[model samples]
Target: MPYKRIKWLILWTPTVTIALWEYIRHTFLLPYLSMDLGNALAPVIVLTVTVTLVYKLFHLLEQTSDSLQRERLAKAAFVEREQLARELHDGISQSLFLLSVKLDKLEHTQDKESVQATAQQIRKTVKHVYDDVRQSIASLRSEPSMTEVQWMQSVEEMAVELRLGGLQVELDWRLTDSDLTSKEKIELLAIVREAMLNVQKHARAKRLIVNAFKAENISAGGFNCTIMDDGIGVDDPALEAKGRYGVRMMRDRANAMGWQFEVGRNDSKDNNQTVGTVVAVTKGG
Candidate 1:
């Protein structure tokens, strides 16, 4: 039976049974039994029925709740594993593939300068793959519940990291902790960190701005997070060659959470000139 129905039965069954017993005792049983005797028996009968019925109903309700909780935990674990697999495929696996290709090129190369360049590329690819592995391990070990202050601190840390690379960074965060769940905060922080890394490595911009706020234009309960850089814009071939994997991972993460992800060139309003690149992740609309 459904949970609500079981609760209703538990609540009303005893009362209804007592009322019916009283009506029968007064109307028919009184002819055969004394009024005092009937009244004395009523308490014992009601107590026995209520205890038995309530015990059985309570057991059923507890079982139903436990089953639902187990199902939810199982589903959440499955989704987490799937996302981890995708991250490995997009980040480390692709980097390893590129590393193999570079090794093959190194074998055939005869010139000294070319060999040095290929070896350098191999080392860079290996370092990137190593970083990805470490990041995955850290994520697996991270606490599941993150406070609002911790979330903000994580974002600030990313900004501080970028500053060390000689890029000017500004933050304009408006969304409160209530705006997103624990899982949502983790995924959003990952996306933002990826965007900042892209800017650090490939944007070649003098300034970068990060913004997070509720966006009415998107939809009800919608949020917008944008990372803007005054860099070479979306037309840069270097970003396409080196930063494509990170971008793909970001998009995949956002899509997995049913959010919108977009990357485009930031353009001037008065003129048609491209100013920089904008990476946005939005929820709802």
Candidate 2:
């Protein structure tokens, strides 16, 4: 029962019980017991009933709340599993397809130079697939502690993986290990990973620069992360369409955390050509 109802019940139960006892004392229980005795016992009976009923009702409410919470967590876990499955399928399937093509080429070509190049490409692709699987497994198996140094290390590892895809990555870290919440850290890690994956899958960039650190001049008392890629620069309509999902997901993560996200082509000072793509996010205080 709700608190209001319980409060009202406790407030009115004594009066109602006394009224009933007065009406029934002369007719109902007087034949078996004295009127004064009946009056004394009626209040005790009412008190017992009130206490027992309130205790049982509150216990039920507590149980129900616990059950609802468990259900919610279960649902969230299911959704996360489904999303991971989709990501692995998309990423691993592409790598496997490329690997198969290279193998086929190696089998058909008799030229030593062509075979050597194909074998090298296969090794690189295999390493990338291995890294992806390892990261995915880690994400599934455990939630890492939200420590600043560890989070940065994970970003560095991701940068290493991007290097496997031939993207040169530069990391600029300046943030102090303070004031970041666990939720913020998790969301930031996810956003960074997704952004890097997008770069590897579609950016076709030769160089990527990731700057993540605290800024003293920022109004929102939070850190900043900018990922710049010197690639074809998100100009191709087909590539844009393919990358839209990742961009949307990153934006959603930032918005959900009350952060700011911006993505666009980095135009040169001459304004004559697209230089690269920049994905920038700023977390709010």
Candidate 3:
């Protein structure tokens, strides 16, 4: 039952029970019983009955409230998934159509260099679009009930779908014993998805690794998540100009969740020219 309703019930239940007992006794039972004796016996009977009835009613109300809450949540999840599906259909479908037209033109054209470049560009665009659709589907299907381990499993599954040079993902789960709240799991999953999507779209790296570890000099339950890829290093100044909203969005999400977000080039330990990108997030417990 709602708090207000329960409050009112508590206030009025005793009053109504006593008033009914008094009315019954005055109208029909005073002649058979003494006033003092009737008053004591009537309250006992009225109190017992009131207690039983209130217990049953409140139990039923609580059950109904729980059922309604679950139903509402289910409906909301369904609507969100449907909206995501429609957006994917509209965006990816158009891109695929344009890609088909380009492929057809390339097949009929005699120009070698132009045909090769167009084909390569179309291939990259197709892969990026496919990755986007997969990520959207994965996000829509994800549930807050998932635990950290289960969330990581889902991430691995999504990684398999990337199919970038058979992109190998190494997960270093140092914080496996840690417990994360449902909201934390969802937010962390979103950050991971954005990171992986960036790798799929721009990294062009053969290997990707995600490391989860406890953060140093932080409060209890603080942890850090980092994704490293041997891709081209990011240019901080040109990122926004290059229309890379994914990185910005990830940073914004981390900040909103009170996590520290960092993205930059992974310094080469061996001093080789093979620079890479690193995206890291540190969150408090």
Return the top candidate by TM-score.
2
Q: How much is the lDDT of residue 17 in candidate 2?
A: 66
Candidate 1 per-residue lDDT, tens place, 21-58, comes to 89999888889989799888889888888779878888
Candidate 1 C-alpha error for residue 144, in Å: 10
lDDT of 1 at 187: 85
List the candidate 3 regions with Cα displacement exceeding 4 Å. Answer: 1-150, 270-275
TM-score of each candidate structure, all chains considered together: 0.51, 0.55, 0.48
Off by over 4 Å in 2: 1-70, 76-121, 124-141, 145-190, 203-208, 219-221, 229-245, 252-258, 264-276
Per-residue error (Å), model 1, residue 232: 24
lDDT of each: 0.79, 0.71, 0.70
Please give the RMSD to the true structure for each candidate, in Å: 8.8, 6.7, 9.9
Better of 2 and 3 by TM-score: 2
Ordering by TM-score = 2, 1, 3
Better candidate by lDDT, 1 or 3? 1
Instruction: Estimate candidate 2's RMSD in Å.
Output: 6.7
Give lDDT tens digits, candidate 3, residues 105-206: 678768898788778867976986787677666764554355424657656654644542256777776765355666677667767867876776678877
Error of 2 at 45 (Å): 6.2
- Compute the lDDT of residue 136 as modeled in candidate 2: 71
In candidate 1 the C-alpha lDDT for residue 91 amounts to: 58
